[model samples]
Target: MSSQSSKQMALVAFMQAGSTSVYAGSWRHPAADLRFLEAGYYADLGRLLELGCFDLMFFDDRLAMPGIYGDSVAEAVRTGARPIKLDLSSVLGVLAGATSRIGLGATYSTTYYAPFHVARTFGTLDHLSRGRAAWNVVTSVNDSEAQNFGADIHLGPEERYDRADDFLQAVTGLWDSWEDDAFILDREGGVFADPSKVHELRYSGTHFNVRGPLTVPRTPQGRPVVMQAGSSGRGRDFAARWAELIFTGDPGLEVARAHYADQKKRIAELGRDPQSVKMCPMAYVVVGESEAQAQEREGVFLNDLVDPMASLTLLSELMNYDFSAHGLDDVVTDELIASTTGIRGLVQNLRSHIGGTVRIRDLAGHRATLLQGPRFVGTPKQVADQMEEWFTSDACDGFTLAATHFPGAFDDVVRMVVPELQRRGLFRKEYTGNTLRDHLGLTRPEPSKPSERGDDV
Candidate 1:
């Protein structure tokens, strides 16, 4: 929807080149369009997002394939079988080169990597992209990811988030290691960097100790924009404190509003501007010329589901539980669910947003009423209308576009839907800012004030 100022809502496309090759029966669709590890796949997708005037494209990643379903990797792989695993950062560079203006974001696990390394890697990417870079901060969730990192077990949820909080503090600290005026070319004295301007992070926390400074300086945005995907209570608090953009999966409008309200309340309670943290909900669009055509397309996509069982397995892995033990009719009430880990928070959010009578086991299998992810399906105008309602109603700050089928579907969105949004003046006709933060309307955050920092004992 366009604001009175004519600022249309923002769109971010989520894609992994291999997302089509396997995982969730994606390869089975006649229109799934799978390709080997190739740069052209990303290049083509990037061009589509650029054409659509999307604010950015983020690569959602996991360290390893799904290993939780029935405690075997066979189903996930046999379905050709999902995330089969690939390096997204190398591919992001190719996508960055393919398109201009559209921001690029990648998920990197803080639990596994040192904060200083995150500073250097994303800082370098920000430079490489000419300031169009975003980092989706995540603590690796599943056990498969842990084993891949050479650890026999995954850290407990609270412990992982504790480490994550410290990690981000240190990474951002490193980004600000060199002040804006730190580099001074004093030809007379033959000195380049002014020693007085550079300061050490000296980050010492319960989970990590990142010493002093980093090799890389800050990028155009001062730092890569911080993005996060967590709707749990603890997750929401963390987002309020650190995230500039938050992603969520609220299946219904009611859920969206509840989350929107909760986050805004928290943002206020934390004493941050309500506008500072945008709560963007995840949405997958399946567009057609007409409503009937869209429904038909949805049917075809469901029929094309390469492996029915694998879709459920993916959902199971997401919930961090075994959804297969029950049937589609099996029900979970408010009190029946429990978790030793803090994952119950996610479950509560899902139930509250999902609404109505829900069959616990239905979460598995091929097509669901809510589908595999949060969804919006209809003609372009119909979809745009829904987007407008959400944006204006404050249901979300924006939406993330996930391709139902690639290239063709995404192309339809750019060609058909984008023009409609433009006519309404809900979106930008041209690039407003050079950096991703500018595109997202975020002020570059300065270093912590002297008092915001804690003094040593």
Candidate 2:
């Protein structure tokens, strides 16, 4: 990493293709636009975040709708809890057309999709965006998502990561198949490309078997920047080996610092530079002209906008455990915790936050407002102060700002908080480079040689 005084923060906007943000109640905010189904909505968002000089804007996705709660999707749809999940590839195309600088990213599960398909899709996206594409790698969390892919059960954590490890190898191999200078485009000589310059992937792994080169040409950035948000040990290991941008959801400064150190150490142990992998924790910032005004803005969302049942439904979906079987006041039993196949890190964090026996209601309440990460509510300068402290304290490389509402929440940050950060010399006043790697201070990856390739291929 650069010295603390000179290291500028890498800002990312956390986005969703559905009705609300990660905060389930955000759609209920009067200021939030309800036209999320339209491509124009995301296009506007893309342009706005680009204006703010955000390094990247990525969409979080789930393969299936929330239905684990009482084994029904009725309550989720009725409460407007992410019932409209649009395919991100189309949305990302709109965003690529709308913005010129900011990076575009979307989630795709390694478990559900074929590696060749992912390599082609993101490679094409990188070309479309002129090297501004990123891919957030995820192993689908729940049986609901598994069933959506026609599987009877979700893989356990170990198995999921194991498959993901191979999945990444195959994808990267296919991406590396075409040398940067392979395309000749020489119609005069009738030689469109050079054969020796292009090679076959022949990637054969435990989870994937890719026969040859990807359909897409070499991308501008060599490959799309790899983003991962895995808090579990196996997940972290996978991230350490592959991820260039690591997203985290830490509740406070101390916890975030520890995670940062651990991840960096893991990366270093894997023979990679720790600074090459940027660590960004999610933060929900409610900025206003005054601290009181910001607090009021936050209060409305936490106290009024959120619906209890909607939160419970989300909690069930995320944890992969049906909370409906237990009463609101029921203790979060050890058995219940052990049975959770979803985000186990979230359950542990909740236990730490409670500092005692956790109840179903407590988890519901936590999920209702902002699932994880710290909430910063104050004047623009005050929020910047908090952000600066975290950045300089080895807590994170920067932040992935979560919006309480769409467009408007981003508008507030771009109009208010960004200026403060720029004034403080903590963030970029303008984008210094074109590609996503350039914005994030990452180097373009070189095409892999056959000798350097994994044995699975």
Candidate 3:
């Protein structure tokens, strides 16, 4: 476990395989690259992040396009509001060959995919990357995603978590099918592997039932480091149980500190070491040579690029509701709150930010800007100072850096901010180990039954 004095922050890059990032205005930035459709774009990104000595970079993905607003994809596509989403598996494959040290990850939803497929895919990735693999698990939202999978409706949050519990059980069981020493490669004896060491996972659960050992052998870091990015109460509990890294979007320093403390307490109550699970909030930074210049750049260049329709479209997509169905001034209601099947944490954040009641216009504005996360606008030293304050205050373990533009946003952070962080000794100066687990200070788990694994913390 990392003591407070010795605890260095673990940084990750929050990413998407699209033209823009979480910010709707990213693609329009004069410095933003528009070649997301090609493999080279992501390769360049991977290399840049690795050069900065970032711990991991995971692509956040959604199964369906943003078609909830006005029940059409036209506005989303026309404004370039996250309309394009390439297959993450293929993109990660490209990165696997491009970079060596930085951890490569991609989001895969448990709601749509089968456990065996997810287990096999990530297990193979872990091997191919030579232990530099991570998987961001998500219980998908959006009925449009359900529709694409031939389902008429999306499941409620309770049902989704319950199903996810079982899904994780089956997948981890499959990952643990082979022991560490299962593959012997005995040539003279004419045997490739020891059959006695390889065991079959005859898993029978509410959501899945798989019988047999996986095709792949035990992965180098046991399994790719498990990552989760949910912040609702149930979501927090789920993360405490499974995730080694948890990504969040707290709006300010106080909120972040509260969240960090709460999550740590929850982990401790579950008999897990609080330090074992790193809680990293999303940070949207605008770096420049001077603080005044950075603020000017954000005010003049970045903030103005958000189209109104893009804001409404993204809001509708995330809430799984139609903004066009109501007027901009319409007050948010209990019914409206209950109806959302999307990110419950985001809706809650919206409510808290509004205080009494939220309006459609308020939601639109927040969605247009960075959603419920602190945006650092300053020079390298100023940005680093803010980050150091948050780190020392127990507000976060680190940050999931969100981009305002593609290469430019990343380039600025790597070249300007990272060195300051390193000088303070709040972040790593160099990678000490190759695997994602090593990067995060987690132990390589031994093969064990699903019921017995998390018990040891």
**Top of the candidates by lDDT:** 2
Q: List the residue pairs that clash in candidate 3.
A: none
Better of 1 and 2 by lDDT: 2
lDDT of 3 by residue, 1-457 (tens): 1222466888899999998898878898888899999999999999999999999999999999999999999999999999989998899999999999999988999999998899999999999999988889999888888889999878888899998989898888888888787777889988898777677777788988877577888899998889997788999999988998999878778888888998899999999999889999998888899878999878844357978899999888887888898998998887887888888786676677568878887878777777568888899988988888888898998999999889898999999999888877778888999999989889998778534332211
Ranking by TM-score: 2, 3, 1
lDDT by residue for model 1 (315-368), tens: 656655566676667877655455424245556666665568666654443233
Clashes of 1: 7
Number of clashing residue pairs in every model? 7, 0, 0
TM-score of candidate 3 on Cα atoms, chains taken together = 0.96
Weakest lDDT window of 10 consecutive positions for candidate 2: 448-457
Using all chains and alpha carbons, the TM-scores for the candidates as numbered come to 0.91, 0.97, 0.96
Error of 3 at 357 (Å): 3.8
Candidate 2 residue-wise lDDT, 1-457, digit = tens: 2222578899999999989898988888888998988888899999999999999999999998999999999988999888778999999999989999999999999999999889999999999999999999999888889999889889999999999999999999889887888878899999988877677777778978777678887899999999999998887899999999999988878888888999999999999999999999999999989999999998998899989999999889998888898999999888888999998886776677666878988888888878478888899888888888899999999999999999899999999999888877788989889899999999998889955543321
